[model samples]
Target chain A: MKTRKADPKGVMTGAHYLDGDFALAEGALAAGCRFFAGYPITPSTETAERFSERIPFVGGMFIQMEDEIASIAALIGASWSGKKVMTVTSGPGFSLMMENIGLAAMQEVPLVIANVQRGGPSTGLPTLTGQQDMMQARWGSHGDYRIIALSPDSPQECFDLTIQAFNLAELYRVPVFIMTDECVGHMHEKVVIPPADEIDLVERKWYEGPKDAYRPYKPDTDLVPFMIKTGDGYRFHTTGLTHDERGYPVINAEVQDWCVRHLIDKIDKNAEKIIKLEEEQVDGAEVVVLSYGITSRVAIKAVQDARRQGIKVGTIRLLTVWPFPEKRVQELAGKVKAMVMPEINMGQVVKELERSVAGRTKVVSVPHCGGGVHDPDVILKAIKEAVK
Target chain B: MSPEAKNPIENFLRMDRIPHIWCSGCGIGTVVSSFADALEKSRLDLDKVAIVSGIGCTGRVAGYVKLDSFHTTHGRAIPFATGLKLGNPELKVVVFSGDGDIFGIGGNHFIHACRRNMDLVVICVNNFNYAMTGGQVAPTSPEKANLSTAPYGNFEYPFNVPYLAEACGATYVARWTVLHMRQVTTSILEALNHKGLSLIEVITPCVTLYARRNRLGDGLNLLKYYYENSEVRHGADTRTLDIRFQEKITCGKFIDVEKPTFLDCMNTHLTKTLGEKFRPYGV
Candidate 1:
């Protein structure tokens, strides 16, 4: 679908020094997100702070809700009111948000959530960085559904991918996640905000048919339904239950099948269009290093050292983590001798890589158990081992 | 039925979705009827009025209403309504849900919303138990009240909802029973006109579960009990309004005073701080 230019009112359009969290906020504003409901969680608080400070000038709204559950619930409510909405949280808050994340997905509310990764099963290292929530981002919410998740390796990419996250959210009517770690979230760097007209934003596909004919969940050809804002005279109803096209609860297996399939297929069938990977020199490499978020930056350094040592190593940095980019990984697995994956978590995303590779070649995991990033030498050794 | 011959409130209901999931003799339907009557009486643009509900039997009110409605997750109607109102200040958002949804699992949100005085009308149908879940113990269940979970009789204390609302800074507070249909309608209409967080707790009957478990007979018997036991005490101190097991219920418009709502405070503060540079949101 064709996209529109960002609303100039929200565009900062300048090069400024910012952390990833602040850049994520700017990116959201540029993407026409006018409503942000979030709670203060370390590593993610700066985004909410930035938003609360900036949104008033943009004619937008920012609310610090009572909790993460209310934060996400508010975002869904705001989204239906025809505003692009988002929230930022850390691990604990993300866990609180899962139930409503499932609500947003099931109701097909376009929402963006940024989980600034921190070390944890439960508030383990609040001030430290870890990519531990990678798998949780995919499967945290219960039931069978698919959501788009993007990882940014830098403050600049934080701005870029957050815009993409909102676009994907609007395009697919799904909850999208900006999965960045505390290292990048707190790391200050130069981020350039381009002119509003240059930045593309996907507006919601709003239904404009006769009010009486409006069916809240009737899918268009894209397997995504058009949405209507509340108080638009459509008088439509939408629920979290397994619902029919009319958005009414239908307690039947057939309706459940349709509802779940609609949620999953909207992303799965469009996976190729949604998956984005930043590849460097993978055309003819014996070993490939796959990584995302802050680990991707670390992996690049390791790949450079391996190349210096005469190993044929390439890098594939995942920009879009969910929808997995499995097909590309499978193809690369066929050509490469092995793939080495490094992540801040012990083994979250590496499992996906191993599954996608499917024993076509060796897949190695260089896991870090939170609080810090992977050392370059550790990833280099994994690359060397994969090739050997 | 022909359009003119049909119920006047039919226009405000999804008539096709009738034969609602509500049980026979359930008071939730009466509350809905009163709500529709209130909507009609208010003369507000129906198009701009939105209804939000949390999970449970009363949560289904959103689906049955012919308005832009949201049946959200359990215990989230207030925050969802908060979002809806803040997202579009022009839209009048009302939260219609049960006592368990609003006060049990969602108590924190409820208190905070009242504290902020978020612009919303919360119609809480307090049936004294988690009716939708087979009369389980709820935060508002009366002491020693029989229920599915509290089969022997509930020993826990129940909340005085109006008292909680008043303590949390609600701009308007009222209570009525489903038997007092006209009073419920009037209170709802008054709530819709109030500028801040207005909470109207409607004591209703859950015949299938709450009433049946307590041997309170059918919904009609419960209504008869309400008619006989309810006391009209306008401006009564909210603290004296708790409904004990089979005891007299104090019902009235106990609190009504104006305070700047959440948005009002936001716009006022931001305008003062940011001056002409501030583009007032949703203005």
Candidate 2:
């Protein structure tokens, strides 16, 4: 995929103090997102508020949809109509969006969704922070498909990874998630926004072939297909139902097999290029603390404490949570004595970690129910236990 | 028939995808034919027109149409169409789906889309019961009608679709039966040109399930019933448009008035407030 500079009109260059949610909105604008349809949900509403305030000046559109379900549905429509679209919500809204998220995936619409995490099972803790939705972001929607999810632990990453999320969504033609928790979403920090020319963006791949020969689902050299806008005279049809390359519904098992495989392979085959991790001092370490989102920040503190006690602890922060980084985890499993994961949920991504480790090393999960982040001492104890 | 002798509407349909999944004697095909005829008469840029459908028998309409059609999740076509129109105000977005899909599961979207006056033409095929799901009782199924779920007889009051559309602020509201083919086509064309949330409810027969369960015979019998019992009242008060079991079916245009669409209101408001800073979206 080729890269382009951000539209200068949407970029606000310079350093400023902003929260994670507001920074996310700025990042989306910098990445050329022209349409945002969102509903109000705590911890995430600030993103929508910021977007509504700025998008009009940028020659873009913002709609506060009736609900989260309608919000996601609108994003899919706007995306097909030749716009980079997005929406933000918390757990309750995220649940309402699951059905349409699947539709967006099946239709191969490029979209960015920011789920500012909160404690949840059912409206569990709307105002407080929790990373419980980590797994839900990966598998909340039904089906055998893959999506790219990025976890931002601070306001700076909230600004940076969100632009990356839009780029990946355009490059792969799939829904990309900015999975940040309430701590980061509400945490105020200094964020540096580069000039429009300095910020790179991936443009949506548009089909430029003869209108008669255009097929909405025909894959390019890459497994991803090129898109055409609704008013482009292509007269193409696309549906959520399993379809053929022509974008017409084909219900037979053969077409279903092809459709499902294409959706999965586009990301699975390119997982290495899609997944990003930030590691420190992992070489020959006896224990590694593996975490993502806000939990990773807390876990790093524990890692530093362990290292001071001569525990030889290293830290691996997951920047991209989905597409699991299985190969890297498997390789590290053989060498490390154990890996300690502390997340807000009881045990979510830790299961994926254990699966990748395949029992090669001890895996300990420091689980917190919700409403708050984990204390560094608790994670430190888990690391100590894993080493023992 | 040879390829040269294809139907006139073949230009607007995916001929290869036919024969469609719609059952024999189903009136959905007749509605589709009317829609195609309307498209032809409107002479709007086919490329600039998009169709969106929710999941159901009518949802399949998107698949058969040779346009930028979207068969989205159940009960989401309205909001989806809203996005399409706002994304590119130059495009004419249409929502075509069944009564169950529109009024049952997707009632909230319908009301809100109408409330917002989203610029889209909505063609709702009201086949009393949930025909696609094996004749289950629907929000549109009249009281005392037999259905799969309401085997003893449906006791639920059916929605007066035109009334609901009017109450929710739809700019154009009309109703017609499949038997009134030319009228359906005329209303569709008018709605297409109308620049707000326009709704045309086409009462059609679900012969395979709805008719069989209600003992209403097949498509022809229903058409005969419509011919004998239907009344054309163009300006009837929408509040009196409730459909009753085996009763006179009221049909005609009940509401048609001009109002700024969602985009129109948005653009005007933003342009006024922001002055030179705002570039009117999709102008």
Candidate 3:
């Protein structure tokens, strides 16, 4: 009961507050969520259940929907109704959600979804943590579009950055993924809940008046249109087709090109702000470790340990993974003599690092694919081997 | 909003897209007549409504309506209608889908939406076969029903529409044959006002697709079959039809429980609780 913090009504946040679970769920709710509908799936089930219970208490709607498709469908429905909605699941549920995720993008529905990384091509390890959906998150559905994804490394990050994921999703009118591994999802730690007034919540930019005049798809100044919920006065018409400025479905080539290009440019031009990464002690360092999420956490510990052993080793950790920070990789790869990448998957992100850092430095992948996360020692070995 | 207007059908329909697509002797035309009659009589504001249709002969319902509409992918009208209703919460959202589209491939989505009792109208035109796909055997196709897939006879048991709907927790469920025009139309109007998952299954005949294969005659004879054999029981057991499960029961209002739907419960909870802890995180 040492860390049991109680609200005015006095039900201690499950694990009873100021703990791992509370930090994760509370972080999302505090970020201005009004709806959540998700089915229970392994590893990520608690996330959905936790939110469903908490949302009713806090005025948000959390629905334990029928299946993964309906779960995400309900999430999309809630989001269109002007709620910062989200759904959480691991492998199988994530796979079922892919088609609707494409629907979300084609229709430009803003949502916050978290795939707490699990071991899988198809239900490989449900209870265990692995970073296999990294590639799938990018190219899972059958279509053409880009995704904005983030990976939080710790329980504290699970709190602080889940809010960031929500803000980014609303800002872009795109589904923002809060990619967390089991290491981060389950690990117990303290997360300071910043005071209520301090946190900034971004509701979708809304139009002022009228049912007839609103073109649901086209926002005048910003490429991302101002979203008006159905109850609101604006009579918005949006579809999953290549729509014109009016948001009515159109199949003409010119409109199709404009819609696709602008949807991408809205992310690309803002890549600098969106693609966040940590450059750790790369100043005059030869060997660098390319990492992200749990692998980055391991690489950070390994980098520190390697430095103690006098191996001029530094690490590059990616916070935002979607618009893969190739420029940073290119810059670091040229300066460093060699880079070692120890990932949970069978070398997905390393190929990108290699593509960017080609011929500049030897890009080596220390990839492992089992159940649990790649340990710090495994990466420490890669660091030592790279520096050797 | 005049109930006795000239051509009540044209008031609800888009006359610009005239000459409907159902084959000349098809019963879908009769169902559409009932739907239009319902819409006109209900007097729902056209500007604030959306008609969502899936890919089928019935999918064309969206294009024929002047209201905001969508002709979406195959067998997804319910989920799409769910999206529109949840998104707007105020719009009079409706789903227009056919037998094969709703009960065959889209069965999972249909069952789930009913269980959720999402606030929307589901207008199911059960022609008993895939009319658009050249009359293949559907999930709701009559037992011993003939189709391209079942040349001899359908071995599988057909799903009774109201049974499946009521069992899946639909707030309001009703059934009527197309020839029972006034009953079917009134059911559609009532469903629109019900404020939850309400299904009005219209038993139509595919004169071009199903009739040629089953030798069930055209829409006129199909209407005769419905008129002659149908037992108008409000609580008939469709699965265990009285005569050894052979009778195709013309059931109605099977389940009309007033359970709190997803939207009703959602709004009530949100309006009460969203104030106490409406704070931002990581500020």
Count clashes in each candidate, considering only residues at least 3 apart in sequence or on different chains.
0, 0, 2
How displaced is residue A298 in candidate 3, in Å? Answer: 1.1
Candidate 3 wrongly placed segments (more than 4 Å): A1-21, A208-211, A219-221, A233-236, A250-259, A358-360, B1-33, B45-92, B112-119, B131-135, B144-153, B212-283
lDDT comparison, 2 vs 3, better candidate: 2
Model 2 lDDT tens row, A1-388: 7789999999999999999999999999999999999999998999999999999889889999999999999999999988999899999999999999999999999999999989888988999988888777888888888889999999999999989999999999999999998999999999999999999999889888888998888888888998889999888889899999998888899999999999999999999999999999999799988999888888878888999998999888999999898999899988999999898999999999999999999999999998998889999998888898
Q: Where in model 2 is the C-alpha error above 4 Å? A: B1-3
| C-alpha DockQ for predicted model 2 | 0.85
Clashing residue pairs, backbone N/CA/C < 3 A, model 1: none
Quality of model 3 by C-alpha lDDT:
0.74
Tens digits of per-residue lDDT, candidate 2, B1-283, equal: 8866978989899888988999888889899999999999999989899999999999999999988889999999988988888888899999999999999989999999999899899999998988877999999999999999999999988999999999999999999989899999999999999989999998888888978877888889987786578899998999999999989999999999999988889889988998988888888
Candidate 3 DockQ category? acceptable
How far residue A195's Cα lies from its native spot in candidate 1, in Å, is: 1.4
Q: Which ten residues in a row have the lowest lDDT in candidate 1 chain B?
A: B1-10
Give the alpha carbon lDDT tens digit for every residue of A1-388 in model 1: 7688899999999999999999999999999999999999998999999999998888889999999999999999999988999999999999999999999999999999999999998979999999999889999999999999999999999999999999999999999999998999999999999999999888789887887898889999999999999888888899999999999999999999999998988899999999999898999999988899999888888899999999998889899999898999998878999988888988988898888888998989898989999889999988888887
